[model samples]
Target: MKEYHVTVRRSAPEGGEGYLQEYTVPFPDDEIVSVLNVLEYIYRELDPTLAFFDHAACRQAACGKCMVKVDGAVKLACKEPAHETMLLEPYSTRVVRDLLCES
Candidate 1:
Protein backbone atom coordinates (compact mmCIF):
# COMPACT_ATOMS: atom_id res chain seq x y z
CA MET A 1 0.00 0.00 0.00
CA LYS A 2 1.05 3.61 -0.67
CA GLU A 3 0.40 6.66 1.49
CA TYR A 4 -1.23 10.08 1.57
CA HIS A 5 0.42 13.06 3.20
CA VAL A 6 -2.10 15.21 5.02
CA THR A 7 -1.67 18.47 6.86
CA VAL A 8 -4.54 19.37 9.12
CA ARG A 9 -5.14 22.57 11.01
CA ARG A 10 -5.42 21.68 14.69
CA SER A 11 -6.60 23.85 17.57
CA ALA A 12 -7.84 23.66 21.12
CA PRO A 13 -11.52 24.30 21.52
CA GLU A 14 -10.86 26.45 24.57
CA GLY A 15 -9.09 29.09 22.43
CA GLY A 16 -5.52 29.55 21.36
CA GLU A 17 -3.34 29.68 18.28
CA GLY A 18 -3.92 26.93 15.78
CA TYR A 19 -1.18 25.04 13.97
CA LEU A 20 -0.81 22.54 11.18
CA GLN A 21 -0.11 18.91 12.02
CA GLU A 22 1.09 16.55 9.36
CA TYR A 23 0.39 12.83 9.14
CA THR A 24 0.98 10.11 6.60
CA VAL A 25 -1.92 7.73 6.09
CA PRO A 26 -2.14 4.42 4.30
CA PHE A 27 -3.77 4.88 0.91
CA PRO A 28 -4.38 2.09 -1.53
CA ASP A 29 -4.13 3.31 -5.10
CA ASP A 30 -6.65 0.82 -6.45
CA GLU A 31 -9.62 2.42 -4.67
CA ILE A 32 -11.23 5.80 -4.33
CA VAL A 33 -10.40 7.56 -1.10
CA SER A 34 -12.39 10.48 0.23
CA VAL A 35 -11.07 13.32 2.40
CA LEU A 36 -13.28 12.14 5.25
CA ASN A 37 -11.78 8.68 5.00
CA VAL A 38 -8.35 10.19 5.52
CA LEU A 39 -9.49 11.93 8.64
CA GLU A 40 -11.06 8.75 9.96
CA TYR A 41 -7.84 6.87 9.34
CA ILE A 42 -5.85 9.46 11.27
CA TYR A 43 -8.26 9.44 14.13
CA ARG A 44 -8.61 5.69 14.27
CA GLU A 45 -5.17 4.38 13.36
CA LEU A 46 -2.84 7.35 13.76
CA ASP A 47 -4.19 9.82 16.32
CA PRO A 48 -7.34 9.32 18.29
CA THR A 49 -7.25 12.86 19.68
CA LEU A 50 -7.82 14.44 16.30
CA ALA A 51 -11.10 16.35 16.13
CA PHE A 52 -13.25 16.11 13.03
CA PHE A 53 -16.96 16.18 12.13
CA ASP A 54 -17.44 12.57 11.13
CA HIS A 55 -20.00 12.09 13.88
CA ALA A 56 -23.42 11.90 12.28
CA ALA A 57 -22.01 12.87 8.90
CA CYS A 58 -24.03 11.79 5.91
CA ARG A 59 -21.03 10.29 4.19
CA GLN A 60 -23.07 10.53 0.99
CA ALA A 61 -22.55 14.28 0.76
CA ALA A 62 -26.15 14.91 1.73
CA CYS A 63 -25.58 16.36 5.20
CA GLY A 64 -22.88 19.01 5.16
CA LYS A 65 -21.51 18.41 8.62
CA CYS A 66 -18.26 17.17 7.15
CA MET A 67 -17.30 20.40 5.44
CA VAL A 68 -13.67 21.41 5.33
CA LYS A 69 -11.10 23.20 3.25
CA VAL A 70 -9.29 20.75 1.04
CA ASP A 71 -6.23 22.47 -0.40
CA GLY A 72 -7.83 25.85 0.28
CA ALA A 73 -11.12 24.95 -1.39
CA VAL A 74 -14.24 24.51 0.72
CA LYS A 75 -15.71 21.12 0.04
CA LEU A 76 -17.67 18.31 1.60
CA ALA A 77 -15.16 15.86 2.94
CA CYS A 78 -17.41 12.89 2.20
CA LYS A 79 -17.44 13.74 -1.48
CA GLU A 80 -14.03 15.30 -2.05
CA PRO A 81 -11.49 12.88 -3.49
CA ALA A 82 -8.27 12.58 -1.56
CA HIS A 83 -4.99 13.15 -3.33
CA GLU A 84 -1.47 12.11 -2.43
CA THR A 85 -0.87 15.44 -0.71
CA MET A 86 -3.54 17.57 0.91
CA LEU A 87 -3.97 20.50 3.26
CA LEU A 88 -7.07 20.25 5.43
CA GLU A 89 -8.52 23.11 7.41
CA PRO A 90 -11.73 24.32 8.92
CA TYR A 91 -14.10 25.84 6.40
CA SER A 92 -14.89 28.71 8.79
CA THR A 93 -12.70 30.90 10.97
CA ARG A 94 -14.70 29.78 13.99
CA VAL A 95 -13.01 26.47 14.27
CA VAL A 96 -14.07 24.06 16.95
CA ARG A 97 -10.93 22.00 16.71
CA ASP A 98 -8.82 20.57 13.94
CA LEU A 99 -10.98 20.38 10.79
CA LEU A 100 -14.16 20.99 12.78
CA CYS A 101 -15.94 24.34 12.68
CA GLU A 102 -19.07 26.04 13.94
CA SER A 103 -22.00 25.29 11.68
Candidate 2:
Protein backbone atom coordinates (compact mmCIF):
# COMPACT_ATOMS: atom_id res chain seq x y z
CA MET A 1 0.00 0.00 0.00
CA LYS A 2 1.14 3.52 -0.75
CA GLU A 3 0.73 6.51 1.53
CA TYR A 4 -1.34 9.59 0.68
CA HIS A 5 -1.97 12.90 2.39
CA VAL A 6 -5.51 14.10 3.14
CA THR A 7 -5.78 17.60 4.53
CA VAL A 8 -9.08 18.74 6.04
CA ARG A 9 -9.89 22.23 7.22
CA ARG A 10 -10.57 22.91 10.91
CA SER A 11 -13.80 24.49 12.17
CA ALA A 12 -16.69 24.04 14.59
CA PRO A 13 -19.68 21.74 14.41
CA GLU A 14 -22.18 24.56 14.24
CA GLY A 15 -20.16 27.24 12.42
CA GLY A 16 -16.84 29.02 12.67
CA GLU A 17 -13.67 30.02 10.85
CA GLY A 18 -11.84 27.13 9.23
CA TYR A 19 -8.25 25.91 9.09
CA LEU A 20 -6.37 22.89 7.73
CA GLN A 21 -5.30 19.50 9.15
CA GLU A 22 -3.39 16.91 7.19
CA TYR A 23 -3.65 13.13 7.52
CA THR A 24 -1.80 10.25 5.97
CA VAL A 25 -3.72 7.56 4.04
CA PRO A 26 -2.71 4.19 2.74
CA PHE A 27 -4.08 3.30 -0.68
CA PRO A 28 -3.61 -0.40 -1.31
CA ASP A 29 -4.42 -0.01 -4.95
CA ASP A 30 -4.35 2.73 -7.54
CA GLU A 31 -8.08 2.24 -8.10
CA ILE A 32 -10.16 5.27 -7.36
CA VAL A 33 -12.00 5.70 -4.05
CA SER A 34 -14.55 8.30 -2.96
CA VAL A 35 -13.66 11.15 -0.65
CA LEU A 36 -16.18 9.87 1.87
CA ASN A 37 -14.17 6.67 2.01
CA VAL A 38 -11.06 8.72 2.49
CA LEU A 39 -12.70 10.65 5.30
CA GLU A 40 -13.85 7.44 6.93
CA TYR A 41 -10.37 6.07 6.57
CA ILE A 42 -8.91 9.11 8.22
CA TYR A 43 -11.45 8.99 11.02
CA ARG A 44 -10.81 5.34 11.63
CA GLU A 45 -7.05 5.30 11.32
CA LEU A 46 -5.78 8.82 11.73
CA ASP A 47 -7.90 11.16 13.82
CA PRO A 48 -11.23 10.85 15.58
CA THR A 49 -11.55 14.46 16.72
CA LEU A 50 -12.39 15.51 13.18
CA ALA A 51 -16.15 15.82 12.97
CA PHE A 52 -18.41 15.02 10.04
CA PHE A 53 -21.69 13.27 9.32
CA ASP A 54 -21.47 11.93 5.80
CA HIS A 55 -24.01 9.80 3.93
CA ALA A 56 -22.30 8.17 1.07
CA ALA A 57 -24.06 5.78 -1.42
CA CYS A 58 -26.76 8.32 -2.02
CA ARG A 59 -24.60 8.50 -5.13
CA GLN A 60 -26.77 11.45 -5.90
CA ALA A 61 -24.57 14.46 -6.36
CA ALA A 62 -27.55 16.51 -5.19
CA CYS A 63 -27.38 15.69 -1.46
CA GLY A 64 -24.32 17.92 -0.89
CA LYS A 65 -23.40 16.19 2.37
CA CYS A 66 -20.25 15.09 0.67
CA MET A 67 -19.53 18.54 -0.62
CA VAL A 68 -16.08 19.97 0.10
CA LYS A 69 -13.50 22.35 -1.32
CA VAL A 70 -10.69 20.24 -2.75
CA ASP A 71 -7.63 22.18 -3.64
CA GLY A 72 -9.82 25.29 -3.76
CA ALA A 73 -12.40 23.76 -6.16
CA VAL A 74 -15.86 22.86 -4.91
CA LYS A 75 -16.64 19.22 -5.67
CA LEU A 76 -18.77 16.44 -4.29
CA ALA A 77 -16.66 14.31 -1.95
CA CYS A 78 -18.28 11.07 -3.03
CA LYS A 79 -17.86 11.99 -6.68
CA GLU A 80 -14.16 12.79 -6.69
CA PRO A 81 -11.37 10.22 -6.51
CA ALA A 82 -9.08 10.58 -3.48
CA HIS A 83 -5.95 12.31 -4.68
CA GLU A 84 -2.44 11.70 -3.38
CA THR A 85 -2.14 15.00 -1.53
CA MET A 86 -5.70 16.24 -1.09
CA LEU A 87 -6.53 19.42 0.78
CA LEU A 88 -10.11 19.32 2.11
CA GLU A 89 -12.09 22.29 3.35
CA PRO A 90 -15.70 23.08 4.08
CA TYR A 91 -18.05 23.95 1.24
CA SER A 92 -19.01 27.53 0.56
CA THR A 93 -21.45 28.01 3.39
CA ARG A 94 -21.35 27.67 7.20
CA VAL A 95 -18.49 25.85 8.82
CA VAL A 96 -19.22 22.56 10.54
CA ARG A 97 -15.82 21.28 11.58
CA ASP A 98 -12.72 20.61 9.64
CA LEU A 99 -13.75 19.42 6.20
CA LEU A 100 -17.43 19.64 7.03
CA CYS A 101 -19.22 22.89 6.29
CA GLU A 102 -22.88 23.80 6.52
CA SER A 103 -24.85 22.54 3.59
Candidate 3:
Protein backbone atom coordinates (compact mmCIF):
# COMPACT_ATOMS: atom_id res chain seq x y z
CA MET A 1 0.00 0.00 0.00
CA LYS A 2 0.98 3.62 -0.59
CA GLU A 3 -0.14 6.75 1.16
CA TYR A 4 -0.77 10.21 -0.21
CA HIS A 5 -0.95 13.59 1.40
CA VAL A 6 -4.01 15.63 0.47
CA THR A 7 -4.35 19.20 1.57
CA VAL A 8 -7.89 20.51 1.45
CA ARG A 9 -9.06 24.08 1.85
CA ARG A 10 -12.16 24.11 3.97
CA SER A 11 -14.60 26.84 4.86
CA ALA A 12 -17.42 27.14 7.29
CA PRO A 13 -20.99 27.35 6.11
CA GLU A 14 -22.80 30.59 5.30
CA GLY A 15 -19.79 32.84 4.73
CA GLY A 16 -17.77 31.85 7.78
CA GLU A 17 -14.00 31.68 8.17
CA GLY A 18 -11.89 29.33 6.06
CA TYR A 19 -8.82 27.21 6.72
CA LEU A 20 -6.65 24.39 5.42
CA GLN A 21 -6.72 20.79 6.58
CA GLU A 22 -4.52 17.92 5.51
CA TYR A 23 -5.20 14.21 5.44
CA THR A 24 -3.19 11.13 4.67
CA VAL A 25 -5.06 8.68 2.44
CA PRO A 26 -3.92 5.26 1.51
CA PHE A 27 -4.40 3.31 -1.69
CA PRO A 28 -3.24 0.08 -3.21
CA ASP A 29 0.12 0.47 -4.91
CA ASP A 30 -1.13 -1.24 -8.04
CA GLU A 31 -4.46 0.50 -8.27
CA ILE A 32 -5.30 3.94 -9.56
CA VAL A 33 -7.95 6.02 -7.88
CA SER A 34 -9.67 9.16 -9.01
CA VAL A 35 -9.71 12.34 -6.97
CA LEU A 36 -13.42 11.88 -6.40
CA ASN A 37 -12.79 8.43 -4.97
CA VAL A 38 -10.31 9.87 -2.51
CA LEU A 39 -12.83 12.47 -1.49
CA GLU A 40 -15.54 9.87 -1.03
CA TYR A 41 -13.12 7.83 1.04
CA ILE A 42 -12.31 10.83 3.17
CA TYR A 43 -15.93 11.64 3.72
CA ARG A 44 -17.08 8.08 4.34
CA GLU A 45 -14.11 6.66 6.22
CA LEU A 46 -12.29 9.67 7.69
CA ASP A 47 -14.53 12.70 8.17
CA PRO A 48 -18.28 12.79 8.10
CA THR A 49 -18.56 16.54 8.44
CA LEU A 50 -16.82 17.31 5.16
CA ALA A 51 -19.20 18.75 2.60
CA PHE A 52 -18.89 19.00 -1.15
CA PHE A 53 -21.08 18.84 -4.23
CA ASP A 54 -20.95 15.67 -6.22
CA HIS A 55 -23.38 13.73 -8.38
CA ALA A 56 -22.13 10.18 -8.41
CA ALA A 57 -24.23 9.15 -11.39
CA CYS A 58 -22.63 11.83 -13.52
CA ARG A 59 -19.00 11.22 -12.63
CA GLN A 60 -17.98 11.06 -16.27
CA ALA A 61 -17.53 14.84 -16.69
CA ALA A 62 -20.71 15.33 -18.66
CA CYS A 63 -21.84 17.76 -16.05
CA GLY A 64 -19.83 20.79 -14.96
CA LYS A 65 -21.07 20.77 -11.41
CA CYS A 66 -18.16 18.95 -9.79
CA MET A 67 -15.57 21.54 -10.58
CA VAL A 68 -12.84 22.28 -8.04
CA LYS A 69 -9.33 23.61 -7.80
CA VAL A 70 -6.67 20.96 -7.65
CA ASP A 71 -3.12 22.25 -7.20
CA GLY A 72 -4.26 25.73 -8.22
CA ALA A 73 -5.73 24.41 -11.45
CA VAL A 74 -9.43 24.10 -12.06
CA LYS A 75 -10.51 20.54 -12.84
CA LEU A 76 -13.45 18.23 -12.69
CA ALA A 77 -12.75 16.21 -9.57
CA CYS A 78 -14.31 13.06 -10.96
CA LYS A 79 -12.10 13.16 -14.00
CA GLU A 80 -8.76 13.79 -12.36
CA PRO A 81 -6.40 11.29 -10.83
CA ALA A 82 -5.60 11.38 -7.14
CA HIS A 83 -1.94 12.21 -7.17
CA GLU A 84 0.60 11.55 -4.43
CA THR A 85 0.14 15.01 -3.01
CA MET A 86 -2.76 17.29 -3.85
CA LEU A 87 -3.92 20.75 -2.86
CA LEU A 88 -7.69 21.02 -3.19
CA GLU A 89 -9.97 24.00 -2.88
CA PRO A 90 -13.45 24.93 -3.98
CA TYR A 91 -13.95 26.80 -7.19
CA SER A 92 -13.54 30.56 -6.87
CA THR A 93 -17.01 31.58 -5.84
CA ARG A 94 -19.17 31.91 -2.81
CA VAL A 95 -18.38 28.79 -0.86
CA VAL A 96 -21.28 27.17 0.92
CA ARG A 97 -19.03 24.83 2.88
CA ASP A 98 -15.70 23.18 2.35
CA LEU A 99 -15.51 22.20 -1.31
CA LEU A 100 -19.08 23.19 -2.12
CA CYS A 101 -19.20 26.32 -4.23
CA GLU A 102 -22.20 28.56 -4.70
CA SER A 103 -21.78 28.84 -8.40
lDDT score for residue 34 of model 1: 92
Instruction: In model 1, state the lDDT of residue 38.
Output: 91
Residue-level lDDT of model 3, residues 4-101, one tens digit each, is 89999998555567889999999999987888888998999999888877897899989888888999998998999998999999987777789988
Worst 10 residues of 2 by lDDT: 12-21
What would the per-residue lDDT of candidate 2 be over residues 10-52, giving only the tens digit for each residue? 8745555456677888877865777777888888877888776
Q: How badly does each model clash, as a count of residue pairs?
A: 0, 3, 0
Candidate structures ordered by lDDT, highest first:
3, 1, 2
Residue 60, candidate 2: Cα error in Å is 5.1
Candidate 2 segments exceeding 4 Å error = 12-18, 56-62
The TM-score that candidate 2 achieves is 0.80
Q: Cα deviation of 28 in candidate 2 (Å)?
A: 0.8
Q: Give the whole-model CA lDDT for all candidates, comma-separated.
A: 0.87, 0.74, 0.88
Report the C-alpha displacement of residue 45, candidate 3, in angstroms: 0.4
